[model samples]
Target chain A: MVVNSSAELTDDEVDRIFRALADATRRDIVRRTLAGEASVSELAGAYSMSFAAVQKHVAVLEGAGLVTKRPRGRERVVRGNPDAIRRAQRLLDAYEQIWVARIGRLDALLDDTPPQQ
Target chain B: MVVNSSAELTDDEVDRIFRALADATRRDIVRRTLAGEASVSELAGAYSMSFAAVQKHVAVLEGAGLVTKRPRGRERVVRGNPDAIRRAQRLLDAYEQIWVARIGRLDALLDDTPPQQ
Candidate 1:
């Protein structure tokens, strides 16, 4: 049998990803980490918020698969997960495609109808 | 001066668009309407929810500029707004670009660093 990948995420997973992305701060964190891997301490230093608050934000992104942590010596490094971002982008593309198809149909309909009533 | 277009949406507008897309049911409604223009009644009939619930969902979409209502005789026709969708997609694209640029910088850094001690 063919195995399903993360692309086949459940409704709940989809909800989590979108919800995680809804917050501006969380989105910023994703961008920062995507630029370079950073330890929790470094991230905490960059933001005005406390270390605990930043940790919580990181936890949310982790939970949503937007970021991943790996042990680097004593500290854990956080990096953005590009695959997850692409997956989310794919969903938006699918939504756009539907709209495009609808517009195409409307154009055809208009062409088919006579000019004057 | 050239007028600022919808592309320069304020933070609140960004929040609304993302929040509107966070719900699966709302996302489904977007997909359905994007596939074809749908009336409030026709949408409600397709879903398991009541007419009020469907109307509320459409209202949320309309408020976010994801969809629009056009008065056609007595009934109001709901059509997905492609420009709004494109605006949202552009935001996502910007996010993706940040990640891509980050990876590029990392690659450059790695290349610059000496491989061995």
Candidate 2:
């Protein structure tokens, strides 16, 4: 099957995903949420920043589709979206793959020709 | 061998790498350089932006260690650094790994527990 994965993220989505991940606090939030879900207040408590700041960070992550917030009674639970993480991973993988392929081609060319000396 | 890979990127490097990747034009430049080295002028020719704007983008990528420039005669050839891309990839992999592990534990818990009536 032709799987449509993070490998297919548009340029805009790539921008959003990378931009969302650009902050240390945001990346940490992602790491925490991936292990388990947390409320915005709970996440805020773990950081030195104000609750409003944490909320804004969550907002950016959510905007990038990196995390999702669901209402649970009185609190909003934030959970990391693994698919989004994988999508970003795939883009980085593409860059790595291109580099690896180029190296392979260069290696092949070196092997095909005799020593220049 | 205890291969220390991109897995070793500090929070600061992660921030820079992702921030550098956040721009579509910068990413395209990375892609171009990965295939083969290109002069800044060559890259600028492909975009509608001014030469100075492209130079600024290249500087960002260089500062992030995503690309490097070396003087080849009068022009500086910009080339993608695969190791840096791998570093960013490893960081993303860590996020994905945590999510997968969480899912694994969830699955195990579901299996261990009896069905709810």
Query: Could you give candidate 2's per-residue lDDT for residues B1-117 as a string of tens digits?
Result: 113353466677778889999999999999999999999999999999999999999999998889989999999999998888877877888888999999999999999999888
- What i-RMS does each candidate reach, in Å? 1.3, 0.9
CA deviation > 4 Å runs, candidate 2: A1-7, A111-117, B1-7, B111-117
TM-score of each: 0.83, 0.89
**Best candidate, lDDT:** 2
Candidate with top DockQ is 2
DockQ of 1: 0.65
lDDT of 1 by residue, A1-117 (tens): 112245477777778778888787788888888878899999999889899999999998898888999999999899988777777788888888987777798899999999896
Tell me the deviation in Å of residue B86 in model 2. 0.5
Over the stretch B4-101, how does candidate 1's per-residue lDDT look in tens digits? 24548766677677788888888888888788787888888888999999899989888888888888887778887767767777887887898888
- What does candidate 2's lDDT look like per residue over A5-40, in tens digits? 535667777798899999999999999999999999
| Candidate 1 residue A19 C-alpha distance from true site, Å | 1.0
The lDDT of each candidate is 0.81, 0.89
